[model samples]
Target: MFMCRGDVDSQLCHECIGNATQHLSSECSLSKQASIWYNECTVRYSNDSFFSVVDMMPGFYMCNTANFSNTKSFTPLLFSTMNLTADEAASDKKKFATNERVFEFQTLYCLAQCTSDLSSKVCGTCLRSAIKQLQIHCDGKLGGRFLYPSCNVRYELYPFYRSINVPSPNELAPQTKDSISKQDSRFLEDPFYLSYNCSSNHNTITSKNFNLLLSYLVSNATAGKLYHRVIMDEIVYGLFMCRGDLPSRLCVQCVTNAKDRIFSMCLSSSEGIIWYSHCLLRYSSQYFFPNIAETSPMYRDINITNHFISDQNLFTSTLSNQLSELANATGNSDERYMINSLKLNDIQTLYTLEQCTPYLSPQECISCLNDMISTQIPWSFLGSVGGRIIYPNCNMRFELFQFYIESDEARSSRNPSKEAGELFAQIGFILFL
Candidate 1:
């Protein structure tokens, strides 16, 4: 397989491929499987089947000689910028993306790409892996890159990529740090397709009924319904729920993305569900409406900040109080959604958001949130500064800094200012495989 970076012009791509073919054959001629990455293109050939699959091994890492003047200030910026860029690359038609972030006295350029043969869902996962690996090998470096058979990521202080492809941050007026973080989170939310799942069963008889159930969902989505549920022929049950604080446009986008992704991920299964940053779509052969049973966590993430909490007991105690307030507060709302913030210590403020499916009663929602506090908090966080847990009926997230907005910020968002905070804000994501 041979592939060019999306931004590379056809002529340059042709030259790069020619050079790669010659170099790979001469250097690794005896090997049945070999990969080469040039400035403009990547080429790989394997004896085994690899197309459309994620191949992560036999990778390389590059780090520049220079180091950042302030690793403390640069860590979060690098994390969020690379994350957004990875998401964009996965969703783009070319399976490639580039972005710019204004470092204090300099500009940071980033590029991410995946082989076009991979699906958007897998592409996102691959690029995220590349980012983590790059950070592991090149923390605080001024420039770095990770190259794999299926995906790659690079960041530099200089414009190492074509300028025409990336949007210029210089054109915009200066933004405060808080505003910049909000913009980053907004960018993060756009291509934030997380994952999709389903039960491990397939039935030819129920497939037709499931299609009909999806049609009902499509009609609701067309009519701009943020929440809807329907039962079809007593065989298939389906529903979709958008985050209550989202605008109609984003709710529509989230639902549409989920629908498109679900068909790709779980079409043959009797039960299917896709989760995004702002919306969730699900269908099942079993009836689960208006129920609040405790289910295992479908997905979880922890932002690891080394030595963040001086007192583990106090940290857990403080977090418990905040989560209780958040659950009680959200449980009172008709929307069944709420945003909250409480200063855990002088070190940092803990910001949290919680929500349950609207069909559930407030009491049921509270019960669900209570279960989250009791079961998830101890097993998941592990003294981390940030964490999130997603279940079938409810989800919640908390961070040392604000990671959400009261409303969608597509054109309109806030980021709390950070006075003095700890370093190393790398977040780890785990799906129940």
Candidate 2:
């Protein structure tokens, strides 16, 4: 059996497999049974078939060669993480697992993997054997890996695994305790507003009234209504919605940026919508909250890199199937959002994302998505490689690459202030039209 380390990146896994095969053939040429382990992969060959069988012999243990001075706390946490990781790998469909645990001084990352051919019970037994071997041979080491013909486990202070490649709105800004506090304050104390019937009294509604309404809306967000509304002074109706995936900190920054930009740009319009990468801020004199229909304005952005080929029925059909499935899934979910994917070949894949404001019922969500698929989306877009269509209540998007990170994946920040400012400037210029 041959297996790659579960935590290794794809590129390294391939390279390590090649190296392991070549070395194992040369080093163990006389033996009837041979196995080799590399940093990223393992290879084994035997005269007899070893499928579905647990083998503990010919095991190897390698440690970091450096001893940890802080073994008292580190040993307990390391062993605990190893046991938990073993359980996770045994239960998961992949028979592989990675975990990170934080300590007072640093974080520990661990991975456990068994050959896919093993049964869950057999895999669990193999990992337990490997863990015991690791403890006996490398208990006080800074890092170590125990390798057997059927399973392997490793731990390190630094991250080693390649995480799923999904982009998220939270990437625009890092979450910090101070940033979370600042975001909460910004939403309550400052809000954008427009008066429809009272041009004369537009200036009459004091800043206090706007703050009070915005404070209510902000509170709604804390309660998990990312899309929420409030009425101010019995006149101004305001609504704000954060992207469902955005963290609280980025949500706040995005909304604050929208509010500041909209207020400065559209000073007295009776209706307006400010769109950001992670959120939307809108205010209107007319009631638009809980909009169940698909009549709200829509936004579209398309990728122009590739067009459909002449003989691409398989590709087109696969794309449509995935998108339709995502639409159905999103409509049926409590969050009203879902992601789906389809593989066209070894090299090409399509990913789709669809979402609706949670206020909409399942039927309303379905209707809203159907309207976009039929009317708003152009036929030519279906031939393109990627595109996004965003709406107030519902939005649908498809691309050739994965775009959304799962909720549990690790998150990192990318600065978005400059781009957001530029977008606000463009929207401001368009407001006059």
Candidate 3:
């Protein structure tokens, strides 16, 4: 059996299913019952009669361990959003619904689904069970996923899905940080795990030579010249929009600096990604955009202390408000913004950075930033001193301490100043965010 969200892109859907099938077939060949999950789809095979029946057996729940700032308000809001999305999904023919709702200033993204074969009631029950299970397993998590045999529920702070109803540029604006974070909760670390049809082109390599050439350039070029040269070579075409926000010289320098570190850390794999405090570099022959490929490698620092707060809800809620304000302010401006705030415990501070590709309209930039913020909040490592969201088109990050250098002149700040009005508009006609 296979299940997937209806809203996912066709190519991504197929790729996800294909991976699940191949993995399950090989990994569980002898077992009578087994299931495999990818970032985009899910596949299962069982000897017990489960084709039409809603089986909640073998359920799984995964959640971020971080606590929220305000438990009372956050829990109710979270439950309500999940319940609403699940109902919509159960009633819909495709068994999928992507929803964004507001709680205080925070916006939450949620996805709920069931196998197409199951009845609405069964799906609802399965989702409820999954939610209940998450309470025990995930508790005060920033994000969590509950998977059942017939149904599933995912809630997060970011937009994990590419909606079928793509918003027009005018309608796209930076949403509340809470909303973004909630949406991110639903995004699977691997989008291919959901249910969808697989195709022959699922994992086709699109540009092997180009990626190889870019890797070679990254390896040979000095840190200062590497970024511009890569862009000139068209290897970083997607990143071109960020040029206006970054100084031409500094942009090249940053890319070069990042390349040196990334090459040393990630090596020159044709299909790997290397992330730095300032930038991210991914060179994959496999096309990752539009189709929702989730194979990008992830790394988390384990050195940060994982101290749990006594009041999880308070921490999360407060953080959500702060993030929402930053997102809105940054989204409204042409330039990017960074803000750092101390938590209730003076020992720790929440750091945030928001940026849009120079090409994007303010609204588009906001929307993209909102999506990144939502997803990162959920998957962020517990007790993480730092976290980041690096999309092909846009990027954002936050850390406990200042990892980026800020120029004393203030005019040459690492992140563009919010006070700089319409910086992108003055640069070019094309919107890059």
Per-model root-mean-square deviation over C-alphas: 22.6, 21.9, 19.5
Which residue runs does candidate 1 get wrong by more than 4 Å? 1-191, 204-209, 303-313, 343-347, 379-381, 407-433
Candidate 3 similarity to native, TM-score: 0.44
Cand. 2 TM to true fold: 0.44
Residues 1-433 of candidate 2: C-alpha lDDT, one tens digit per residue: 6787664456556666676666666667777777766555677888888999998876777565446677998899999999999999998888999877766434566889999999999999999999999999988876677888899998865444444332321222111232122232222323322111212224334455555555665566666666777776658787777755556665666566666665655455555676655567766566776646544566665432244222212333334434544565566667776655554445655556677877788768766775565345433223344656667778776665555553443222211211101111000000000
Runs in model 3 lying further than 4 Å from the true structure: 167-433
Clashing pairs in 1: none
CA lDDT for candidate 1: 0.67
Candidate 2 Cα deviation (angstroms), residue 13 = 33
Each prediction's Cα lDDT score?
A: 0.67, 0.61, 0.51
Candidate 2 residue runs with Cα over 4 Å from true position: 1-225, 303-313, 381-383, 409-433
Best by TM-score: 1
Worst 10 residues of 2 by lDDT: 424-433
